[model samples]
Target: MPETGDAAPDFTVPLANGDVDSFTLSERLEDEAPVVLAFFPGAFTGVCTDEMCTFQDRLAAFNDLDATVYGVSRDSPFALNEFRNQNGLEFGLLSDYNKDVIADYDIEMDFADLGVYGVAKRSVFVVNGDVEVTYAWVSDDPGVEPDYDEVEAAVEDAA
Candidate 1:
């Protein structure tokens, strides 16, 4: 997993909001803005819904801090778009359908009890304009969520 001060792995993935579009981490880095990558196991699940909704609720604060937030999951763009629309989320959701990003971030995990394999562990990474990690949080349990206040503080510092 990437630690603080380490370079965040760059990725180009399909971003789903109201419509599908391409998103590139490296390209966003050029804008010199703080980026928050929130990874969840799946979309439409209870915990995932709450986590994402929480981010949506806190979006204004993050925006005030000049930070961009993205929720990531191993779901198809169509499914993600539905999830975003249903949740009324303003931020984009990245479709890691191939699970490549999870592997790159070393956050791949399996939900043995659910018979699910190769899903992204719940994780949050704060990357500064320089593409370096300013904060990192990962949960072994899918039910866990990141500390919103801490993430806000991290983005504030990065900004």
Candidate 2:
């Protein structure tokens, strides 16, 4: 997990929209806009779907705070497309299939015991214009999730 106050690593990952785009953490933070980068384990999973749909349902609240929300996962673009379309996602759900972004953010999972492939631990980062992580939450237990109220408070403060 990236430490708070550290500069976020930037990466360009594939998008479900059939375009390769890059998200520069610092660039997003410019003009004091807060960026909510939510990394999930995979697509179509129970928790992941609920997590993303929660964001979709409250997207306007985030927008009101001038925040741009991004959902990142290791799923392929096709899978991401389906997930977004099926759930009526209004934000970009990026494809980090290669795990490069996951590595850069130090969110990779260990597959030794479960025999699962590399997965991103569920996490969220609130970044400022200078690329500093103003707030961050990485789940110690993969089964758990970040506190939405805490995150919303952070977003409000950042705004």
Candidate 3:
């Protein structure tokens, strides 16, 4: 897991909108705004749905903090589009289908377990524009979700 003060690894991935773009950790923090990068195992799962829905429901609070929220998973763009529409998600859910982002972040799961392969573990990273990781949470149990309050607090502190 990445600790506070460590530089965030920058990467670009395809979005559900079919646009290939890049997001650099340092560039994101340049405006002095914080960013919330939420990593989920996959789209359309019960836990993942609930977790993203939570973000959607509280989108205003996050916006009030002037933070940009990004949901990332190994699911393809098509799957992500369906998930976003079904959940009415307003934020961008990035598609990291190739697992490059996950590998760069070191969040890939073990292939031997549960027959699931090429998936990223549930985690969240709060990064500042300087590419520093202000806060991070990796779910101890893959099925569990991170505490939003904890994340919100971290964002507040970082802000």
Which candidate comes out best when scored by lDDT? 1
Span of 10 residues, lowest total lDDT, candidate 1: 24-33
- Candidate 2 is scored at a TM of 0.89
Q: What is candidate 3's CA lDDT for residue 98?
A: 88
Residue-pair clashes per candidate, as listed? 0, 1, 1
On a 0 to 100 scale, what is the lDDT of residue 156 in model 3? Answer: 83
Candidate 3 or 1, higher TM-score: 1
Off by over 4 Å in 1: none
User: Candidate 1's residue-wise lDDT over 60-108, tens digit each?
Assistant: 9999988999999999999999999999999999999999999999999
What is the clash count of model 2? 1
lDDT of 3: 0.83
Give TM-scores for every candidate, taking all chains together and pairing residue i with residue i: 0.97, 0.89, 0.89
lDDT tens string, model 2, 1-159?
678878778777776753446555555567646888899998888888999999888888888888888899999888888888888898888888899989998888865687877789999998766677878899856778778878888888876
Backbone clash tally (model 1): 0
Point to the candidate with the largest TM-score. Answer: 1
* Winner on lDDT (1 vs 2): 1
In candidate 3, which residue ranges exceed 4 Å CA deviation? 17-26, 111-114
